[model samples]
Target chain A: MASKGTVSVEVSDLRREFKGKGSPVVALDGVSLKVGQGEIFGVLGPNGAGKTTMIRILSTLLLPTGGWAKVMGFDVEHEPEKVRRVINMASGAEKAGYDFISAKKNLWFFSQLYGIPTATAEKRIMELSEMLGLTKYLDRKFYALSTGYRQRATIARAFVNEPKVVFLDEPTIGLDVMTARSIREFLKEQARRSERTIILASHNMAEVEAICDRVAIIDKGKIIAAGTPEDLMRSLGAPALVMEVSPPQSGFEMLSRVEGVKGFTASTEEERGLSTVHIVVETDAAARAAEDAVKREGLKVVASWRKQATLEEVFVALVGRGFKEREEQDVV
Target chain B: MKARALVRLWSIFGEPLWIVVSMGFPVLSSLALSLLYYSIGAASYVGFAVLGGVMVSFWGNVLWSMASQFYWDKQEGLFEIYLTSPAPISAILIGMSVGGIIGTVPSALIVTGIGWVLFHPAVNAVWGGVILTFGLTLASLYAMGMTLSSLYLAYGREAESLNEVLQEPVSMLSGLYFPSLGARSPFPLAIQAAASLIPLTIGMDALRKTLFYGNDIWQVWPDLAILGVMAVVLLFASTYALKYLENVGRRDGTIGVRIR
Candidate 1:
């Protein structure tokens, strides 16, 4: 439960397991969190981090294998209908509605599912379309709309029901920079009203940092850390260290083994023979040690500098591995 | 229900080309039976075959449009949304069935129109029996469709294959081209008993009594009773089955995972 304010969502030790080819795979392992009414909560995780799984459960689309969750004071498992009535969810990767119909028709179709009156739904659709820059494309067939517009249409559909709580899973993923920012601003504006709570699960660190009131970092089906973004970043203590090497090198696993190198990411520009290494450190001494370690590995560091702290750094500091590295690591 | 029904309506009426092509269905069904009977030197039975063709067409639409539609919706990602809404899954399905009936009626009429032109089967205008039997048959058949819809919802592509597997054999089993239950049928007792299990078979058998022989509602009350019972039981079973199978899908983590 939330420590302050009116609690809108209460989750306790929620566990979800999927049957694997040889063994069961745990998708959500003992997740618990609370979002107070009118708070914007962000869940930060890499691909396949059980963020979507949690949102799916909260929205009453999936039942938990264990534990329990309550949305708007109704148990998700026992009173799913009640939960559904109060909450709505949107996934960035989802494709919906009939492709043959216009985007407006599709929105109208979904609005009717919630039994929204036609006039009210139409007014909402118009407002959302204009807000999302989808007004011009509303008449186009869904199959004809661009991916960005289609995603915008989907977001509009999510809001047409006027849900008390909305779950957005990577809502701006794969969007253009401007569109993503606009969507962020839109969500931020919605949160500003303090009339509803928004729970968004995203892999984009900046997005979470920019819009979330509080954040939780999840990986390997577990919440590794949770707190305000500033508090979490301050927990790392040292500024992130970035090293540029003219000749890119592989085998970044060695850096993780180095003392003081909490977690480091190595991206190679092989054709350009350059690599950028972003390292999270516990102290200034660790940043210096990471620089030394890079040189000892026979990769000449052309330049080194400090960068602003981010959720990625927090994830690295907490798990001792970068998001990309941990995500690539196999989980059963 | 209205939402799904509207989508159903649009999809059915979307392409003028498909609509034009769909009109060929009843003609082909009616013509094939008439020709088959004529070829077998059993031209007198062509009336039975003509009427059989119409029922078979309705059954076919129930399979393709109503039964398999849930799988299509899941693939399109609407089923998850439906699951999350306050709207009952059964309502969506019932809506689809209602739309499917509307979409199917024109073709059914075309077949019946052909029936009058070629076979001239007796329809002594027992309007009450005819409408009641027609209505119950649709209700029971759609309820049976709702059962298949549950299977399609959870099993995905496997249950879709059942649509194809069910098409022709069901027509044969239901005796859509012949009477299966009476001594008039060539099949053995075991076959007749098996055919009786299909609601379409019962509905069509009842339809034949009323449409071909112009039997009154009193004369064919037993078949109506069976169809009514079947509708209620299947509808009840389907309602529970939809919920149970959806839960199974959720437990398996397969509900929202789309696959070919």
Candidate 2:
């Protein structure tokens, strides 16, 4: 992958098990993948899918129970010190700064831990804070900052050392849309500007599609699919069609009976007296056939369009369930 | 590393009001105990009470700064960040211990000054031996505290309760307020022997003998040797315990967050 030295991270059959309440729970089982230098790699998974566990192991924060992982060519288990020196990670699970200290001081403290020179650290902190829209909040106590600012500061802290490899686990989980978009853009710019290898683990499919150069869909501690977004979408071998209808008729059996229309799901907006149907079809002709089938059902077709399969569709096709549904099931 | 340690010390004692209250509490407590000794016709024992106050202040530093730091760090997510960093865990612990000492030094000095002025105990003109004894006592006490911290690191909030549980008993058993020996002493020989096993007991005894009784270095060699051995043993034990617990914590996934 990427001709040896160009490979920034290489994981092989990496395994980790947690001592569950009554039995051993496998968080990761024989998960293997490789990421090249300067690549923006996205890891997609449902709840309990081992994405954070994999990031933790690779970042040298947790040791794997079996197999191996390497970061920047250093074995994570055997040469953890070297690996740690070259990497940093940001996670949404926990806030990562001293609550009593100012944001600047917190970054300074971490920079000292990384042995960054004071002058360089100061310049880097200013640059990152300015870029992340955190300059005004830099003097404020970390606990006093809002959630978005805190998340941004944590991201800035991770980048303070200009690490060769960075792991971001749901870095934008609870942010507002604008904040999340800004962070996504910043991550992309950083990856492009520095040629940094960034592994982003997130549940947001659109975010991944917008920023990731390549992605791996993980389910049940296994990498079920890995490729560029285009490659994965192309593998589905069909396009998706969206049709908006009024009066919310549900006679979609005719659409499925059509020659090229594979299947469709209809959702009604009762308050608005409208229904939107998503149909999977082999071609544009199938979409027209589905529209005709809907018209034959006496439902007024407002509009219809054929679109390429989305990453969400590809994920569902591979995993057999929608991400939110799987997440809800996990909660149950 | 040095700057980081200084920052830690500053965080603990940076506020003027906090420094006054923290240092004032031990000094005032020691003065109260000294006045009680004077009222009981044991005015000469005022120095003992003052020394006990210094040891209490030291205990506070150990409990909050060295021991409970693990819990606080985990709560603040600093422990996970520290683990993922290239810095050695020992370095962080050492920085914390050094900061603790720095934060407690003012209280210690104020108590020592009050004792020296109040009792003017028959001073060991040999200042070198007295200083060595004081230094060793602090080191041995810190080493023991560090060993206890390793156990508390696994105990989480229970460590706070244990800190309360330990305060007075350790002082009493260490002869902090009164001598554990001599004909007038109430403690049995076996009890004194058991108390002597505690580094603070031996350290306090050696300090009192050298500083108050004017004992020579040779005369206090036995206590010093015992303290030296205890310090080494506790330091080694604490180091091993920390490494073992860290590995167990990693396996259990408990190091990054609170277990309870």
Candidate 3:
């Protein structure tokens, strides 16, 4: 972690409402948070949780209907051009100038927008391409690249200006696992080695937990929870311990009645013939107490262990439903 | 940067060129109409020939310009990208107009040349200079297209419906295919008035009066005057409209929403 100043991003009660066909949708309702410099801050939420809205406002692509947000002390709405100069955004929605020019030309054009000298721009492009594995396709037309390469190109374009702050909205959405992992690693390296501030909006729990210094979970266009990933999972309590009962267990009805258990249920899929059980425990003693009951009953436990609750589990426990459930919440 | 912007301009124009090639109906209709009039042997041979040539250039210019320039941008999702960048909206729109002129210039020349070859139209050299007014007319025409494009930005999801509804009515009212100046009925009068009020139509009228009838530039000052007014007013209106639309789009959480 780098020693930073007061704040890199200070979003103060920002509000954005969208006028739908029927009622006005409150895309972001009085959302507020602060991200320190040189940190990877993640915004986690289900689809349409106003993640993109927040990123847009921060990037100066959209303005808040109420309140204010400042990037590096510059107000987004009032000083959009200044904000634009200091930051760049890459999203799945980014339409590269495909069918129009080569990727290198695209990089050169954006470099001009940042007012970088030609020599420096070329050097930066070479560096970014090498780092992102885009050198092989730099001269290719944008439409010719695969989705993974295209996204890498977009990431390179976002950093061509050496922007102080980078906003990546769903940077790894729809990517293959390996590609997503590489992108996450690249983002982490960019933040750690270059000391750049990043605000990543994503629904991928593992990616957010692995890379983020702090995660803010947004639901219904509001930040429902904010903390480090470990802190959040810890706060959600010991998540449900999942285990597979092998060797064709006929029934597990007695598993629910175990002492110290808050609640328990099990269902079997006939094709797989594996019975899965979900148990809620009153305390740490409950898991141990329930395990003993299972063994005493002479049921072989194919696998048993206490694993840390993932961000996804923590989210479901908090929201009474998963993030995707609230996607239709009036936040555009 | 200038070269890159120029390339973007070319790429956007390229899609519309395909449309112009695909739609041969309009050109055929214009030539057919010319053949009908020529076969009828209607009055003043010189007048008909020159008038017919001017009309073809006017219609060909406007139709090809509209479909190839503004329509293609809306279709390709390029407008969203154009709006998101730091480039001034006016520059992008102006660039589109320049590309449009480039795309349509060939068609206009071809259509006019065909009319001349087939009809052996008598053209007055003095009146032909009126084509220079294309510069002013194009500026105002581009502004009008941009004004409509602002509406597209504001209504992101409904952009297609809005764009589709506006094209035919605007072209018809602008009198791209007929002698709007002589229209006498109230409906036709309204169309003529609208055409005369717009810079492109006015400029086209000047070219027709001059080339076909040998009228001097001074005789067509009325049309030029209208064009000058439309240019100033439309330019300001277009700029103001786009600025307002952009601000509204930002607030509604759809600033860069892809219309296509």
Candidate 4:
């Protein structure tokens, strides 16, 4: 470990390119960022946006074609062994550990790889299994455990060494809501208790918003924005307003005409004869103005509420499109 | 260290049936081949056939148990976990090789016991040279297997097919069933030259010379020296290959690829 106050992860002009059919595809393009010790940093991006690539680089699993990155003050390229000693990663890309072995046995084997003494590893495994609600499942073979339990085992494996930095790439993908919530809570508790830097790369916006202290939105292999979740939503400079109107309003032209109402999106429910409109305004007064305009238009207001912009809205506003849209475009 | 070794050992022996098949295959082949040699009026070659059978078993262990384990671990996503650990790759391979040896011992013993009982071949009586030759042969073969694994790691799914492609050809070229020495041997000049590149050939020839021919250690120094050199060269080559291929795999985003 470096000093207590030192940056845990640092990257500058980092680039990783893969050979494509015609030319090289840049997975990471001049990406640079820093994460402080004990910080829960989130990397949010669509498919093919290089979130996994960046995690791989920082965790010493991949080499950068250009520029540099350092994890825990150890250069990833030159000091890979040192970096590996202090960091661990878990990803949803694949299930790790031997299928024939018990989950506890898998954790023990990995702890051996890290040179953790057997006694200490056993103790740690018990503690983690208890904390993650995995104690009963630890004796089951990895193949026999459910997906959620297998994922929990993988997470426990990553923390076996009590690493200074942990890289989690969508650790909760495809799990049921309760399972996902449990993992998120475990991560939050770990971050708070150990003060270990956690770099979480995920597609779950709500999960990131709930647990991450800061987040970076990456698009097209570049980070478009990085800030605290609140700061990012605030940076949008517009409060979100959701309004339900009866009679299925023909259009949202009147609300759009309201002062400081930058834009509004409307969806209609034909069965319920109701139209729901989401209006973005620059201020609270603008929200009131939009409500008055809707009322003056002779549309019955069934319900209305003012709310802060969510991270998903902030991401769409900054990236100029929804995450799924970009993912589909990239696939084509 | 102890834990890794135990895990490797348990991984193979935990299922007794796999070990039974692994050991039975070679012994059965040895019995059939020795009978064929006896029926052909080459009764004295029973020792040669037995040695070939044992060596074949060793080669099979190297290919499937040792080499293919790399592919399995990669496919199972355990390789990446191994890489992230502070343990050196060499340590892991060594543990695996030791386990493979332990798991393959029954086959070796069965072949040796059957040959001794059926043929009563002349013993060297020089246990020192025999044991030394045996150890060197295992070391060289393991080194070669490690090198092969590096290629397999890079090749991914194609590695399984490649293993099949290489198995019989290597067995033939390395004289697993027939002696490569003597002028009447069927192997041609070019074939012999190519087979010599395989460490197992050198090891098997040396082991046969020292054990069956009652030769002294010094008499087989050249063969032992060649195997030692091959072991060193292949070990270094394997290390470099593993590192280079890992980088290329990472660059191609194929490190965790499990399509096959």
Candidate 5:
């Protein structure tokens, strides 16, 4: 990892509330974090997690109602113009640029918004297109490009200005798995090579785990967990117990009685009646005790394993619920 | 960049298809209306129909290309990027008005040229007064557009509803004041009085005074001065209104239409 020296983005107790029809909706309630220069910081959250709100505020697109945010030492509210000059954002599936124009023209047009000269902007556009695998599609009209190509072009436009800070809101969304992986690799490489600070907002756990230097897990408009992925999972200090069992209905009753178990959830398949029950136990003895109890309950322990904790488990550990249990948090 | 793009549009497309459409509507309406004058043997007043068509083009351009453009930008998601850029939204909008005027001028000129060719309305224009009137009208009209653009972006649909009213067309209606003014304009005295208060109406009245009546700059100076003042005032209003509306967007957390 590159030296994380200076603070590229400093957000402190940033509050943004939307006036809801019935009442006000608070999107970011005192959310605070600092992203160091050259770090790929990830804001991970389920739907309506206020990830986009933070990105928008940091990008100077939307204003914060209370608290304050700064990008590259410029206050996002008071010095938005300076912040905008240093930062750029690309959102997944954003319908930006003129459809009638080519992707190259679109990139050039946006670069002009930042006052980039024509020759320099063109050179940068070519470089970005090449990096993003969009060179061939550069001359094609934006509306004609495939979704993957269009998304690549959008991402390229974000980087055209060589902005010091880049905000990518779900940048890999709606892409094929291979494309998503390649984009992630490219972003990782770009951040390292250029020493650029990237603030990525995504819901993909594995992607965040793989690329992010540090991750913040936001739920219900608040950050529940923030640290290195390994550190976060390790901090759980619990091994997850995965079991596949037939006739598992009665076995859950016995397993719940096992000590040292922090939390457990089960998924029963209808056709096979095989249940995949995930148990978070405080110790290895708890896993063994739970397995033996399932066997004593006349349930077939088809398969079982004690695995290292994941961010999902860490989320469950902290929130006392999995990501899927929450309702969609509407954004402003 | 937008200016160059428009110049490119002019190059490839030959004045844009809208020029034909915008020019066509006015030319046709003016020709049909002028029949009212010829029928009553008041042919001398055909300049009213001719000049009215010409000025209406600028007003229409202001209404759509300037005022309601933000709504379209928001709907298309372009406004999001615009909002994030280093250049403030107001600067871009004012720039757009410049480009829109560039794109709209050909149609205005074409209308004027055609009106001159067909009707031959004799004009002993006071060149100084004419230039001042035309220049102030353009400035004030576009400044008004800037103000509308800001207010509309702030209020969203409520201001968007006003976009349906096409152009400041009262100049054409006030032609009814001349018994032999060629067209049978439907404007009542109340509307004419109210319309007279607007900058466009004042500018157009000044333009007619200079163009047809051959009034000197001193004769039309008051209208020119009012237009100059209106231009400055509206320009300032546009900036303040935008700032106020943006604060509203922040408070409401909507950005007035964050992403369509």
Candidate 6:
């Protein structure tokens, strides 16, 4: 394992810009991050947030326009080959080893590129295929496989080298729920078993929270917040508690009258014979009192749930609600 | 390291023997058609078969190999995997170059065998083997082809247009089909002389002299020297140019970036 204090990846005031005939547009604006060895670090952002660009730079595939990054104690600009040796990258946009060849042959070719001996490469390929559930389709052509299978093969390819650092951008994008979960579990296993440093860039909140030990939400080429999932959720303050009931509930009306209750909104569902009441609970404990009042009144409580703020909410709050559609709006 | 490079080449082209066969067939057809017209003259027939029929095809194979090999890799995503690996960029290029040779060798032998059967051509056996022109020519042409392939990544879809534009000029200047008639006017002569200095032309000329005219190796030393120099120079130049292009492509996100 790497020494606890030693950073596996370090970015210092890094910036990247795409030069055009008219004006260069900055993709990263003074972005910086330091990830320790064996940690699952995540950079969460919507489209056009420079997440992929940062991953590319750290993987030694792209050069920074300003500042610098070091991977495993090697400067990205001066010692790229060494940086490349220690890390492997998988991006959603990368569709490699797919045409006119079997997935196994592609992996075998990559194994040679990584300098793995022939025997060792075959053994590793078998092991990865089994772990990633690709044994049956190993002989099949890449284009014939589903997106999930292709992605699983890609994950196996990334870890086949057993490098100390790995970058995965949107590892689970476009995958079914079960496949996404399996991939997340596999990534977690890799981090633990190999002591590999992982940098996952994705917009999937649940997947990111499930695997990432720490996450930085990036917006407008800058990180808005960086912390564990719980800490980030807590930073959003007390959540609003909303309840749906079968009959009109008079108890919640009382709770809203209490000093801590800020306000209440109610809407009745005529088809289901249910009234949905959303109350703004000023304090964390108000959710409990509201639940008690609903029970005391003997109302048929269909669902009583706190609207717990999630990473998605955090992203929207920091990056804005129209992040998806307006990513390229202010490219200047 | 050389062994590893060799293994890489074998993996790339081993099973797909058809790719090489397809490239060779057109050249063989050209020779067969020529045979239907001109009875293979017995004099210097072996050299003529090797040089005249196959030599031009050999150069054409080099061009096709360059565009096809990396262009296939570019389409397949192998290029990105290659760039990300610990292996030096030169290793991959050289490995592919070696495979290109393997792919082209069968066609060379076929042209030679067909000529002997049809023409009963005379060849200065001792002089032909001593010159080593054929090997030098193949190496130089392979190097030149690879250098052109590297430019494919930077130009994107424009690579096809760029390649088409260079096709006529490269063939005309290389002079595989027509002899450099030796500088009547400084323009065509200068071009021909420069073309004669290329390894393929030298190799082709040396083979023509040895097989057709019954000349020995000593009689064609100049061709050997020119072929040797061009091969070494182009090999080194191609290797360096490919590495430079790979580096630039990665920075621009062009290596694996999708056009759509």
Candidate 1 residue-wise lDDT at A276: 86
The reply for model 5, stretches above 4 Å from the true place, is A1-3, A20-24, A238-308, A328-332, B1-24, B35-42, B158-160, B166-190, B256-260
Pairs clashing within candidate 1: none
- Model with the higher lDDT, candidate 2 or 5: 2
TM-score of 5: 0.84
What is the iRMSD in Å for candidate 4? 1.8
Q: Tell me how each candidate scores on DockQ against the true complex.
A: 0.61, 0.46, 0.33, 0.47, 0.37, 0.29
Cα lDDT tens digits, model 4, B114-179, are 988987755554667778888988998998888888888877578789889989898888888777
lDDT of 2 by residue, B1-260 (tens): 56557766657664677688778878888888888988898877887888778877887787667777767777777777887888876677667777777778888898879876876644544577778888888788888877887778788778778878987777788887777655535789898878888888888888778767888899989888988998889888888888888777766777765654
Worst 10 residues of 5 chain B by lDDT: B176-185
Write out the backbone clash pairs for model 6: B44-B122, B44-B211, B45-B121, B45-B122
Candidates' TM-scores? 0.94, 0.86, 0.81, 0.87, 0.84, 0.80
- How do all the candidates rank in terms of TM-score, highest first? 1, 4, 2, 5, 3, 6
lDDT of 4 by residue, A186-303 (tens): 9998888998899999988898999998898898789888898898889878778889998897577776567877666677899999998777677889889988998888888999
Give me the displacement of residue A232 in model 3, in angstroms: 4.1
- Write down the TM-score for model 2: 0.86
lDDT of 3 by residue, A263-308 (tens): 4445566677665555555467888777777767676666766666
Checking candidate 4 for backbone clashes, the offending pairs are none
Answer with 2 or 5, whichever has the higher TM-score. 2
Residue A253, model 6, lDDT: 52
Write one digit per residue (lDDT tens) for candidate 1, span A238-320.
Answer: 88998888677765666776677788777888777889888987678887877777788788898899987788888877777
Candidate 6 residues lying further than 4 Å off, grouped into runs, are A1-5, A240-306, A328-332, B1-17, B20-24, B36-53, B67-76, B118-124, B127-131, B181-188, B246-260
- Model 4: CA > 4 A from native: A1-5, A237-308, B1-3, B114-125, B247-260
After superposing candidate 1, which stretches have Cα over 4 Å from the reference?
Answer: A1-4, A20-24, B39-41, B114-125
The per-residue C-alpha lDDT of model 2 at residue A32 equals 87
In model 3, pairs of residues that clash are A27-A331
lDDT of 3 by residue, B103-178 (tens): 5555556666666677775566563455655555666666666565555555545545654565566545554554
